[model samples]
Target: MSTPSHAAATAPRRRNETVIVFALSLAAMVVSMMQTLPVPILGLIRTDLGTSTAGVSWVTTATLLSAAVFTPLLGRFGDQHGKKPTLVAVLGVMVAGSVIAALATSLPLLILGRVLQGAATAIFPLALSVLREEVRPQKLPGAMALVSGTLAFGSGLALVATGLLTSGSDADYRDAFWMATGFAVLALLAVALLVPAPRHKTGGRTDFLGALTLGTALLLLLLPISQGHEWGWASPRTLGGFAGAAVMTAVWVLVERKVDEPLVDMRMFVHRPVLMANLAGILVGFGMFANFLGVSYLVQMPEALTGYGFDASILRASVQFLLPGAIISLLASPLGGRLVSRRGPRAALGLAAVLGAVGFAWLALDHRHSASVIGAGLVVGAAVSFGYAAMPAVIMASVPHHQSGIANGINSISRSTGSAIGSAVVTTILASRTLDHLPPGVPPLPAESGFTLTFGIGAAAFALVAVISRFGLRGGHTTVAAAEPAAADHSGRPTDKAVRTDTADAAV
Candidate 1:
């Protein structure tokens, strides 16, 4: 075994480092909560804004679009400079956005604020980067799991809070933004008070060209997909957006090949673990968000019209989902860390994928009953937390410490892209099936059917992911080899002699 180094011993001795980790982690959780705040109130916002259901869906689409665009860019900046300043900058922008959203009267302005909020969500990934840099290896697994799980837990909490606050007679949808503002303020203060300065300063040229190209490409791609139905999917504007996205992505590939300091390292795509992990991330994201979309509709369906007997108000419906998801998140986060330590990332990921598939399948069958719904939600949430935690661990293990930020940024982007696709797919199905005009007191069976089918589809997707993870993800323990040549054999043994001996015994 390799000896524990002096650097590892000395790193945690600094008082400010501890504070920084705690503070940044908490801030990241708060930022994560903002993403889910509007989810519980999506229906309310739709009614209040007097917008089409499809149009109201864009509130989520807008935030995801901005998040997908900015996550990699901000992460790259953090890697090139330092996480502290980047985090603070993101928090400040988010605060401004929250204030704007709180005061907004128009749907367009609300979307603009959401866009800014999404941009600021990059702080979660940046915090992970910081943790990787500052925390000791021994402590990393748990810390990383906590960071990953917080996204789910915090979002659940935010949704629950929104449900409770908005259920009151005095509160409106705008109160959610104000709540976000308060969270942002607390995050900002925490960052200011607790985060430590980086020990090593970053030395690299900024890849402005790459950033611009990628940004343009993502925007072009996301715009059409996000608004295609509203704009007439086959209309000239939608077609033009698709064409522009294709051209920009093609150019981006060429630009990345030539740049010394590429914003995203295209070569990471070739690494088996990184590539497979990202693919898994995408599928998992799709599966996870599809569940969210399906459950939202399922809970809102009137009891007299549906399989379940409980007729819950909007607030109660939100809680029914939030409580189970939060409990599962809390349970799965630490469990993921333990699993990673024992079985390696590939095994952990495979297990998570399998669990997700089972969860979704269970829901498809059991959604008729309220208890079953909660149980299925818990299972799905646990699977998601596990998968989420394992993904970052896989990426961090596969790349150099310096490139962790970019690798994670890419992972985040993959998840966001998957989420966007999930949203679009679910929305399209519901829209295509549901009639534009509903007669008074008449229910939307087509919409309800669409959601059921979507959940089934998500279950199938997760099943495929589980199979792929089992076979496709290799080099689990050996992931550290990709970054550090000396640490190639991560079997925890010291030398190649030990590796050969173990191989020989296994061959026998």
Candidate 2:
């Protein structure tokens, strides 16, 4: 009779938890949608802004760089000061960026807005950290998966939404930016009204020096990779940037080692599980972006001329090739959570790597037909959901609970770095390889072999992730021998009572 009473009492709490997760997930989706809102409309942007193709590419390049710079910085701040305020600040910035982009009449202004919008990258990791504080441990994995999967889902939806808004060839891309602004505004209100402020705070000093060094190093390293094709791979500018990156890396390591409370803990970061998780994040991210950019490009190639393409509009590419993948990603998210809760993150990652490996391998081998391309994309998108879901599990399991924000932030940066690399490589491959024969009046087209090579490389990266997860994920789910669960009121700082209660319930 008492047990029944306890269960009845807890029912409402569970219902509230469900509502909270739904709200947070919605906010996360809006942030992710903004990140990819401009992807399908770059050509239109080029024409609208009267910019050269090379110049307009900065819209994406600048966003990548800005995301890399801000995610870790703001994440660390959120961990020390507070997450809700930090998240609200980030959302506010995104809204401003979207508005700026919507009203921009010049290329530089649009790029500036994109740079600000890039801060939304921090939103995904922060949402996961908040889930840890708000949801019960038993429910945490599933809640985290929902949030993580939304990233892939929102990105795909963004493409589809952009296509709808700019359906006509002559439709201005600025409408897409306005749509982004609306989503951002909605997200801001949702966070402010629905989600309560953070009760957990791991008070610490902001590592300004460490952040500067890391940010500068990341910028130096990524600028060349993103723009190397235009500048010439062997040009002085690219080489100099790489050299500067190398020097900055050495300096950043020294600074981190000497600081009492470093921006990033050197010892924890290099722990086998944490190190491997970050590495796998890079490889998985590479495969994800490669699949996304490659599929969209392949379908849009004019079928009449290229023969291999579907002659699809941006709308068709998103609907026919991308939507199935997004749907599969949604289906895979909870499944991934179940796998993580049962066998562990290692198993989930292994599954992701296998799916990614097989997906890209099939794409490389049998891409002659348009249907094959769509099928491959569906598989790869599901793989991304698995990978994204598992990644936070690995990070959360390995790092101390208090460090979740900064730790996940670093992991997010790794993914962003991998995306830039994948984008650069795919661009280079397609640009370098060209069809051997073409009619006099026909414009140039990429050889089919370029796509084959890109998929093969993506397959190789995922295969490598499998090997890392298998060997390097030992003991990731277990606490360190000397450390017991810490006590605090906020969910981020779980008390002994809270831990035992969740563990007991899970055992039931």
Best candidate (score: lDDT): 2
Best by TM-score: 2
Q: Every model's Cα RMSD, please?
A: 4.9, 4.2
- The digit string of per-residue lDDT tens for model 1 on 1-508 reads 4357866766565565567666876786787777778987877788788888777877878888788778888988887788888889999989988888888877898889999999987887788777776666656666677778877777677878888889977658998889899989999989876776654445588788887888889889888877876787899988999999999999988898788777766656456667878888888878777877677667776655554435666677768865687768866888887776556566667778777888888877767777777888888888888888788877777665556777788888787777767777777787677644566788664455676678788888778777656666632342222223122233211233211111111110
lDDT by residue for model 2 (156-180), tens: 8898999999998579899999999
Error of 2 at 280 (Å): 1.1
Question: What's the distance in Å from true for residue 332, model 1?
Answer: 1.2
Residue runs of model 2 more than 4 Å from their true location after superposition: 1-5, 475-508
Please give the range of 10 consecutive residues that has the lowest summed lDDT in model 1.
Answer: 499-508
In model 1, which regions exceed 4 Å deviation?
A: 1-21, 43-56, 232-236, 306-309, 434-448, 475-508
- lDDT agreement with native, every candidate: 0.74, 0.82
